[model samples]
Target: MFERFTKDARSAVVDAQQVARAAHSDQIDSRHLLVALAESEGLARTALADGGLDVTDVVARARASIEAGDALDHGALAAVGIDLDEVTRRTEATFGEGALARAGRVLRVRRKHIPFTPDAKKSLELALREAIRLGSKEINGGHLLLGLTRAESPGRRVLADAGADLERVRRHAEGASEAV
Candidate 1:
C-alpha cells in the first residue's frame, strides 16, 4: 500500500510512523496521515486554508464524531444534526472544486477502509504531491500539523476561524520525536 505513494508521500508515511512512535500508537491511521499531510508543504494545506479550514480541528471533530458514533451508532448522525449535505457543502467550501477533482484521483488509489471521505483523501494526496514537488524528502509532523490548514471539513473551518496556530502545534509534535 505504501508503494503507491510518491517520494513525498512515502516520506509523509515515514513521518507519520515516527509520530506514531512518539504518540505510542501501533499503526498509521488517517489522523496520523492527516498530520503527515499537513507537515508536507503542498496544495493540501493551501487548498484547505483557501477554503477556510484547519487540520487539528478536523481531527478533533473526527474523534468527537467517532466517539459520538461509538455511543450512538447511526443515530449519532441524526442526534448531532450533521448531514452529508452539510459535509459536502463544507468540503466544497474548504477545498474548492479543484480539490474535489484531485480527491477523485486519489480515491482511485486508496483502499476501501481508509476512513477519510473522498474530499479528505484528495486533499491528502495533493498535499503529498506538493511536498515532494517542494523537494521535501519526508513529510514531518509539521506537515501533518498543517492538516487543519489543508482540510475541507466543517469542524476544521471552525478551528481555523478561531485562529489556531496549527503550524506551531505540528512543529512541537515533530520536535518531540522518539525512535521507532
Candidate 2:
C-alpha cells in the first residue's frame, strides 16, 4: 500500500511521525496526520484553506488536544478536591520555575519508533480506497484529505473545530485532484 503512495503522500506520512514525536505521543494518530497534511504544500492544504480553515489554528487545537490528554491527572485531582494550581505554585516555589511541567515531561517515555494508531492506519487505508474509487493510479495528498474527511476520527473533529465544513473540504479536494 505504501508503494502506491505518491511523493507528497509519502512525505505526509513521514511528517505525521515527526508530529507525533514532537507531541510526545506513543502512536501516530489521525490528528498528527491532519497536521502533516495541513503543513504540506499540496491539494490537501489548498482544500482545507478553501474551506476557510486556518492551518495554524488547526495545528494549535490538535496539539492542545494531545496536551489535554497528557494532563488528565489535573482534572482527576480536581475531582478529588485537590487544587492542582496551588500545588503547582508551592512546588514551583520550592523546586524553582517550571517544576510541575518538568515533572510531567519526565513521565513521558521516549520511543525509538512510534507506530500508527488504529484510526490513522484506517485513514491511510481509506486514502488508498479513495484513490481507487476516483480511478486514480496512485494515492496522493488529496486522497488522504478525502479519507480524513470520511473517517470518524479526531482529525475530523479537529477540522470541524477549525471551522471547516467536511463536505465542502471533501468536494474541494476532489475538484483539486481532478484539476491535477
What digit string (tens of lDDT, one per residue) describes model 1 on residues 1-180? 334444555676666555444443333455555555555564344434443456556555534433333322455675788674566568889998556446644553453332444544554564455345445554433334343345555324434444655554434433331110
What is the clash count of model 1? 14
Give each model a TM-score: 0.35, 0.87
Give the distance in Å from residue 88's predicted Cα in candidate 1 to where it truly belongs: 31
Error of 1 at 98 (Å): 44
Candidate 2: global Cα-lDDT?
Answer: 0.86
Q: Which pairs of residues collide in model 2?
A: none
lDDT of candidates 1 onward, in order: 0.47, 0.86
Report the C-alpha lDDT of model 2 over 1-180, residue by residue, as the tens digit: 999999999999999988877777767888899999989899899988887788789888988877676644689899999998999889999999998777655555545778998999999989888898888988899999998889799899988888888898999999887677
Q: Residue 175 of candidate 2: its Cα lDDT? A: 84
Candidate 2 residue-wise lDDT at 50: 89
Model 1, residue 133: distance off in Å is: 4.6
